[model samples]
Target chain A: MADRREPLHLIKSRRDSALATLVSGVPYLAWLGIRFDRRGDELTAILPYDEKLIGNPLLPAIHGGVTAAFLEVTAIIELAWAGLWEEMESGRIVPDAAVDSAMPRLPKTIDFTVDYLRSGLPRDAYARARIVRSGRRYASVQVEAWQDNRARLLAQATGHFLMPQG
Target chain B: MPQGPDLTDRDQTRIAQQFIEAIPHARALGMRVDALGEGTATISMPWAEHLVGDPRSGVVHGGVVSALMDTCCGAAVMSHPAGPASTATIDLRIDYMRAARQGQRITATAECYHMTRTVAFVRAIALDEDDGNPVAAATGAFTVEG
Candidate 1:
C-alpha cells in the first residue's frame, strides 16, 4: 500500500486542505481562533494570543477553560485526521471530491482530565496530541500544551472519546 | 480580606461578582454569579449561537461546559471561608453526562469541599433547567495563593 501511495508533497497538500475543512466545520474552534499546522501526518494546534481570552486580569493569565478548550480541539482534530488517512490511502475518496463534501461527524468527548502545570502567559500557545489508543468503539488521546519554551508545558490533558460507528 | 476567616454571604457574593467581572472570557460568555456562600458559588450563562459546537446538533460544545465549570470552581475557592486571596487551577477532571440543549441557559454550581494549607478541592455540576440531570460534572484541585 505504501508503494501505491501518492508522492509526499501531494499527500501533504491533500491532508492540509482536508484538515482545514475539518477544523472549519466546528463553530467553537473558529470562535476560539484555533488553527492547525500540519507537518506530514503530524499536527500542532496553535492558539493565537487574544486579550479577551484572559480569565484573570490580576494574574494576567489566559483562562484555564480556554486552555482546556484548545487541548480538546487538538485531540478531536488529530483523531479526525487519523481516520481520514485510512480512506485517503485506500482511494475511497479523492482529494477534490472530499473537500467539497461535508466532513464526517466528530467523536463525542466522554471525559477529560486537565493538569495545569503553570499559568499560561499572555502569549501564543501550541499543543500536540498523541492517540494513546484508537479502537473501533473508543479512543483515548493525550495532549500537551506549551508556550514559548517547548520544554516547559503550561498544561496537559487526557480525554476519552466515543467514536462514531459505521 | 483576611485569610482563614469566615466571610459573610453578602461579602462572598461581592467577591464572586467582582472576580467574574474581571475575567474577560467570562464576560465575553455573559457569565454571572447567581448565588454565593461561605465556600460555594453558582454561575449562569445564556445560550448564544456563536457558542454552538456542532451546527447540525445545535448542542453547545463540551469545552463550553468545561469553561463554565472551571470558572465556577475557581470562584468557589476564592469565596472559601479560609479566604486564600486568589486561586489557580492545579488539575481538573470533567465528565460530560450529555450535550447541553440549545437555546437554554446553563448554570454551574461549585463547592470548595476541602482545603489544606496550600490547596483547595472543588466539585461542580452544570445544569440546563433540569436540575436532576446534570449536563456535566467536575472535580478539581486549586492552589491557595496567600
Candidate 2:
C-alpha cells in the first residue's frame, strides 16, 4: 500500500525508528499485506481483505489459516517493535550504524493455538496483541481479531515463541 | 419407503477430489489432492516463490504449512463416514518441530479422530521427501452441522 511502503531511508529521515525500518524491510509482512498502526505503546494491525484470501467459496469467507497467521504475525511484530525501543533505551547497542547491524530480534514460533469465534467476512480485519509474559528465552502472546467491532472477535489465538537473542 | 443407491467408495473419492479442487484458497495455494480415503486425506504443495518466509533460508513459511494442514483436515472431514453435512473450523493448534527443506514439496495428511453430533476432531502432520521426521503437527476441532 502507499502508506505501507515507507522505505528505511524515508523512515530514518522521517521517524528514525527501528520498528519502522523492520516493518518495511520484512518481506513476509508486505506479502501478507499487513500494516501496523502504533498508538503509544499499544499496536493495532490491519489486514485489507482480498479475493486471494478466501478459502471456502460457498460462504466466501476469509481462510481460517490466513486469519490465524495474521494474528500470529501481529504478535511477533509487536514484540520486535517494542523490543527495539527497549534495546535502544537500555543502551546495549550504540545509536548509530550499529543499530542497523543489530537488527530487531526474530521470534521462532514454538506452538500456536487459534480459536475461531465467527467466520471472517470479506472485508478489512483488525487485530491486537496482549503480551502475557516475556522472559529471557521465550515469550507468550494472546491475540484477538475482529471486523468492524473489536468486541465481536472473528478469532482469538495464543502463541509461545522462542526469543532469539540478538 | 423409496431409497437411493448408496455412493461407492470410488464415487466418494471422486466427489471429495472435486470438492477440494473447488476451494478458492486451495486453488490459490496450488494445493493438490493426492488421496482421500474413508477417514484420511493428503494434500501436497510444491515450493513456490510466494510461499517462502525466510528468503535467506528459503524455508517455506510456517503459515503455508498450517494452511496445507488445515485444508487436509477439511478434506478428511468431508470424506469421513461420520462427517457432518457441513462444517467450519472451531479451533486449531499447531506445533512446529522443524522447518521443511527448501525446494521440497510438502505433504500433509489428516484424519478425523472423533466425531460427535456437533463437532469433529482432526489430527495431522506435515512432511517433505527430504526428511522422515514431520515438519509440524496439528490438532483441530470443527463445528458440524446437525
Candidate 3:
C-alpha cells in the first residue's frame, strides 16, 4: 500500500506541477482564462470565450484550432495523471525524456480525427477527455468540447508511444 | 516536374521570410526562418514575456504553438515550387508532447509530404531548444484556392 501511495503521490505532484506550468507558461491560454480540473481518470479544462478566438468574420465562432488545443492538453494531462509520467521516469524502463527531463517517455500522436459537433458560440467553452484504451505501446482517447450545455466538438486520437528498446 | 523556373536558394529564403512577415502574430512572436529549401523549412520563435500565458511568471502560450504550426505548415506547403502562395487549412491535428517551460525558445521543422495542384499535406514537429524533445507534433492539410 505504501509503495502504491508513493507513486500516486508522485503523480499528483507532477500533475499539479504541469497544471501550474500550463497556466503560467502559455500566455494566450492564460489570457483566455483557461483553467484545468482533474478527477481520477478524467480531466477537464475551461476556456472563456474571447473575441480574439473568433475566426469567421460573420458568425464569430471560436477557432477550430483553439478547440483542438484544448482537447490536446486535456488528453495529455489525463495520461500524465494515470502514472504514465512515473512509468517514463523509471529510466531502467522508458528512456526518452526529450521534451522535459522531468517528463516520462510517452507516445507521439500518429493520427487524430476531430468532428465539429456544433459551432462554438461566443461564450466560455469547456473540454473533457478520457482514455479509451491504454495498451503497452499505444493509447486511444476521446475528447469533447462544449459550449454551455451543447456538445460543440468531438475528437478521437491514437498515439504510438515508443516502448523502451531491448 | 512541371515546366517552370525552379526556385533558387534565394527565392526559397525570400518566400519563407515573406510568409513569416505576413503573419501579424508570427511577427510579434519573433518568428524567423533559419533555413528553407526543397520541401522543408526550419523556423524559430524566441520565447518572450508577452508571449507567456501567465504574465505573473513568464511561460509561453499554447496558442503560440498553434499559430506556429499553422504558419510552419503553410510555409512548408509553399516550399514546394508547385504549391500555392496562399492556402487554407482543411484540418490540423496537434499532439502536445510536453509543456514548454519558461523562457524556452521553440523551433519547428516543417515538411510537405505530398502536394497536388489544389491540396498540400504537411507535417511538423516543434521542440523547445532547452528540452530537445518535441513539445508538439502536427499534421495538416491545406487547400490552395485561386
- Best model per lDDT: 1
Candidate 3 local lDDT, B81-132, one digit each (tens): 6746556567677766776777777888899889888888889998986656
How much lDDT does each candidate structure score? Answer: 0.87, 0.79, 0.62
Off by over 4 Å in 3: A1-32, A36-44, A51-65, A77-125, A134-139, A146-166, B1-28, B35-39, B48-67, B83-85, B91-104, B127-138
Order of models, best DockQ first = 1, 2, 3
Question: What tier of docking accuracy does candidate 1 attain?
Answer: high
TM-score of chain B of each: 0.91, 0.89, 0.84
Candidates, ranked, lDDT: 1, 2, 3
TM-score of chain A of 2: 0.83
DockQ for model 2 equals 0.59
Residue B104's lDDT within candidate 1 is 89
Candidate 2 vs candidate 3: the DockQ winner is: 2
Q: What are the candidates' individual DockQ scores?
A: 0.80, 0.59, 0.16
Ordered by TM-score, highest first, the candidates read 1, 2, 3
* Candidate 3: residue B53 Cα off by (Å): 9.5
lDDT of 2 by residue, A6-122 (tens): 575664443345556666655656777888877555789999988878888878899887887788888887776667666654555433324556676467788889999999899
| TM-score of each prediction | 0.92, 0.86, 0.55
lDDT (Cα) of model 2 = 0.79
Q: On residues B89-137, what C-alpha lDDT tens digit does candidate 2 reach at each position?
A: 8999999898888889999999998888888899999999865799999
